[model samples]
Target: MQVHNRRATLTGTVDSWLDRQQAAQEAHEAGAREVNNHLHLLHMALPAATAQ
Candidate 1:
């Protein structure tokens, strides 16, 4: 009984930890996408300059 209870607790904690990690990864990816989009727009808006 005690072993089962311990296993259940550990499983719950692991599930919660994985959930948080997934959320963090998703947020980081979203931020990176936004930053990339901004940089692309900036480059597009700049006039082409010839190097001497």
Candidate 2:
């Protein structure tokens, strides 16, 4: 019985850790997208500025 309980606890801990990891990955992807969008805008505007 004790071994069963221990296994259950370990499983829960691992599940929680996996959830956190997924959240972190989603946040990182969002940040990367924002940076990419900003870079794209900057690139688009550069040619106009240089022509003047």
TM-score of every candidate:
0.31, 0.31
lDDT of 2 by residue, 1-52 (tens): 0123222111122234445455445545544321111111112223445555
Span of ten consecutive residues with least summed lDDT in model 1: 34-43
Off by over 4 Å in 2: 1-15, 32-52
User: Which residue pairs in model 1 clash with each other?
Assistant: none
**Candidate 1 structure quality by residue, lDDT tens digits, 1-52:** 0123222111122234445455445545544321111111112235689899
lDDT of 2 at 47: 44
Cα miss at 33, model 1 (Å)? 10
Please list all clashing residue pairs in model 2, or write none if there are none. none
Misplaced by over 4 Å in model 1 are: 1-15, 32-52
Candidate lDDT scores, in order, read: 0.32, 0.30
